[model samples]
Target: MTGTDTPEWPRCGHTDSGERCRGRTVAAYPACLAHLDGTERTAYLASLTPGADLDHRGTPFTQSLLDELLAPLREPGSGRVRVGEAAFDEVRFTGDAELEGIDFGGFCSFASAVFDGGLYVQDACVGGDLRLSAAQVAGDAWFDDTEVKADAWFFKARIEGALRFCVRRIGGSAMFKGMMCGDAYFSGARMAGVTSFSEAVVDGEAAFDGVHFEQGADFTKTRIAGRACFDGARFLVNSARFDGADIGGDMPFTGACFEAEASFEETAIGGDLSFSGAQLAAGVDFRRAVFRRTARIGPLICPGRVDLSGAVFEAAVTLEAAAREVRCRQTRWARTAALRLRYARVDLSDAVLEFPVTVVGRSRPFVSPEGGVMAEPGLTGSRVRVTSVKGVDAAYLVLADVDLTGCLFVGTVHLDQLRLEGRCLLASPPPGPRWIRRRTLAEEQHWRAIRYGGGWTPAPSGVETYGPGVLAPVYRQLRKALEDGRNEPGAADFYYGEMEMRRHDAAVSRGERTLLRLYWVLSGYGLRAVRALTWLVLAMTATVLAMMLWGLPQAAPDPVSAGTADGRRITLTTTKPEPVNPEGSYAKRLSSARLEKSMRVVANSVIFRASGQDLTTTGTYMEMTARLIEPALLALAVLAVRSRVKR
Candidate 1:
């Protein structure tokens, strides 16, 4: 075993079955790259110290060993070399070497090998598939400016240091399943085929900015502990899915275009999601993506659909200044936050927006932006529940078939300035009873009065006219009139009733009518006329009674004389005097006529004694005369008195 005696060291050839010698020199280490089996190679490499070197002091190495190590990479005709067999402390492949571009055929193992210096593969191409699964590098691993013409599989490979692929291009598919890297940069890399990183964990930031994917791209279940940016990257063919990928920092897809479908379903992004200028040709499905912080998709244009169903934003989901048609079906936005849709055209038909969806400020909870006009005919069947809805100034907004049943609006629901072109039913449909009944006479009158005065004019100062009780029906009729251009009798009837009612009201106000016209008409006028006539009759009767009393006898009878004798004798005398007519001519005429009409004379005699007049009457005669003149004179006196009183 002495050095001078040259103890028999292991030969460079197979010392046992399935082994080869692969080291810079003999006596350096027995477990070199070429002397072990696949399993042994991995185990040996894992046992090395970090930053360990492969070449120790060289001894007398056999010529055969040098030739095996220094042989040029075999041509395409020759089969590929299975390079790494035994584990080494470190495996260093340096110098200006040109490996075969297409010869490698089987699995290449470099698992857990630490390269202390840079492993440069600049401008070199690997024609056959390269497998570096579970390989770890301590120093800088340069795949920069390189091309893998075949499918490159690097599953579970761990690069402890910076891994740069600054301008590398992969012609075929690049699979990096469960790959862990410290800080990886694929700044301008182009993957002509599918590039997948399913479940790969990156401890540091991974930048794929400005990278182009000709086929599809997938990062499903990938955990990026640092920022993972696909900013300005283009996915030309199929989808770029990031479903279940956890991004610990800001994941920006700014200026990226998904030519096909793009998905971020169930992906948990810890920081902001800035897709500010991304263009999505196909559908962008973000169902169930949890944004732990702010999520911004502002200024993005998706020609196809964008589904954000079941996506949760912990902070604000700002879509300010975006022009895409956002489909947010059943999205849950958090409190004290906003889902700003400022200056964006949102098609939320059939969307289920959760409560407290703020549009502008944090306090004001709504979906429409402040000072922003919503495009009409947009949100036909959407259900949005918010504390308030404001700042809508769009004309012809069609909310016809929308179901906003759960919306609870507080404060004033102002439609004062809103120009509703069509029949816009509010979330709460108008109460039915108001519109069910036909217009009453009073209602008709009101409508007519208003129309005559110019419909719906503001009242004069200090006057406010309340709206009609049946506003729904009124509005409906107006809408029909405007739309159909047909005149109905109902309108005219209403106008008539309105005028009549107004006139009656005015009469009542002026104290001109004791009763309303309707009441007066219902009761017959006979009672009023009878009341007036009764008063006149009573007055005339009083005048007649007064005249009778004034003309009645005021003096007592002149005398009745009674003479009493010793033997009870009595005498009575009566004196009668003036003529009936005062006028002398009428008296003469009456006397002459009385004489001409002379009547009969009668004589009477009394046997009993007593008064002088009685004794005279026993031997006297009495004359009777007809006297129409006296009666006429009496009637004239009465008539004269009556005429004087009348005057």
Candidate 2:
């Protein structure tokens, strides 16, 4: 359908006739829709393309003269401008006018040009490169839904007002380096190749919602005074960098991905930052970046490290469902909300975690059997909650002055030195699982004797302080028990017996012995034996003195004697003095008379001190005295007393 074949469209008074028209009137008097008489049409078209002049000097560039172009289209009518089948390859727009919906049919270049008013190319299609490099737009520019067939270069362009490129797709590279826009919107735009906005400055919001970068993209050093949202964007190729960019508002990158390294190093974000569900094939570095509000990188996966070293989050930094091996070196979080790193494998080696921060992990079943390993020392001035860490080799693993009151390790927990003020449970073998039974003391001793050749040190002080000292004693007892057995028991039985003996020894050491006969005997008569020996010696000395005094005549004799008192009665006493010896003599003379009489008494005392054989002998003697001699003496003393009473 050609313009000429149609019927005559309504024409306004601004229409021109004859050769002055740029081309044949398309069955319409007013060749361009902007020349319509309505004020609304004029105003709307004025917003589309500013600085439009119909004539230059005395020559007409279009159908309407320059004076006629100045007149505004009146209200109650739609204003439109159509550039159909036109080759404005190098056209320069210099005046303030309107050219809405103007189509540039082929390659277009307004390079190094200036436009005093707004330029609207809404729904326009450029067949080739659209070079607006170094162009100056004094009013708001609208390129909404515009398609650039070839590479579009707007490098060093200055737009005094807002620039809109909403829903536009560029088939080739879109370079906007050093371009200054009052506000920019390229929402839902698809760039087939690289899109470079390096060093561009947007005074207002720059919205790139649902934008697709088919290849690489770079926004390095771009400054945006307003929000820079690339929500739901995808970078298909590598080398996607927004490094050193400064954003005045929130930079939400929800559901974004970078196939290669995503570098945001040194970027400053004035508002909240979000990168939910973002995936980076390589490392993502936000090192030394500053976020003015909450920055979230949740549910993201980076196959390589995610470095946030020296990055300052003015608010909380949340990292949920993070990938393995995240490096959060020297990150400073200003808000009270802890930087959550749940469900992540974090390598905070050499990291300085400040106070009011919490490093936590997900509460899930043990996914890794080996558990988490620390490659280096981790310093935590803040609290770290690691719940359900299964299969840890050490529960106090290299912890230094860390307050672990709330930390939980529900599986096999290991430690180096854990000074826990609160309670901590050691990981035990799970119930219903195959458990390796603990070795018995006998088994341990046998093993030790065989393996180490019966050499061992005493248990450490800490162990002795905390528990009963039984290891050595148990070991000895196990050796003795095994030696006494004719045949060695099986390993299991030996181990069981050894353990029982160990327990027994522990009890004995704790003074739980059933028979204390040896102790009782040693304590009871230990001093009494010495005292009895001393008394026996004293008695023997007294007896000796008595015998000596009786055997020997007294040195001092009594003064009065029986026959010496009166001498006058001596003659009568001599006749009655017959000796006892005379009776024996008379009996002997009669016949060989025989007579005999005998009386005997013996006293014995013995004391002995010895060990082993000699001790046995002394013990036997003491027992005999206790069981027989002592009792017999008591009976004898009783009988003697009874006989004396009878007498």
Most accurate candidate by TM-score? 2
1-647, model 2: which lDDT tens digit per residue? Answer: 12223223222234355423222221223443333347643544465332232211111233233224433321224333333123222223445534444445455565545566777666666767777787778888777777887788889888999888763778988999999989998878889978899999999999887888888789999999989888888888756788899999888777676777888888998876665555567767888888886555444445566677777777756554344355655555565334344233343322333334444443332121135321211222233333222233332222222222222222222222112222222222223423222223322333333334523222222221112233434333333433343322212233333333444443555443323322222221122233334444444443323223221121222233234435565522233221122222332323211110000001222222221111122323443343333333334334433322331
For lDDT, the strongest prediction is: 2
* Per-residue error (Å), model 2, residue 235: 1.3
Q: What TM-score does candidate 1 reach? A: 0.45
lDDT digits (tens) for residues 492-530 of candidate 1: 323322333444443345443444343223211111222
lDDT of each: 0.47, 0.50
Which pairs clash in model 1? 41-86, 41-87, 45-87, 444-494, 445-497, 445-498
- Candidate 1: 10-residue stretch with minimal lDDT: 598-607
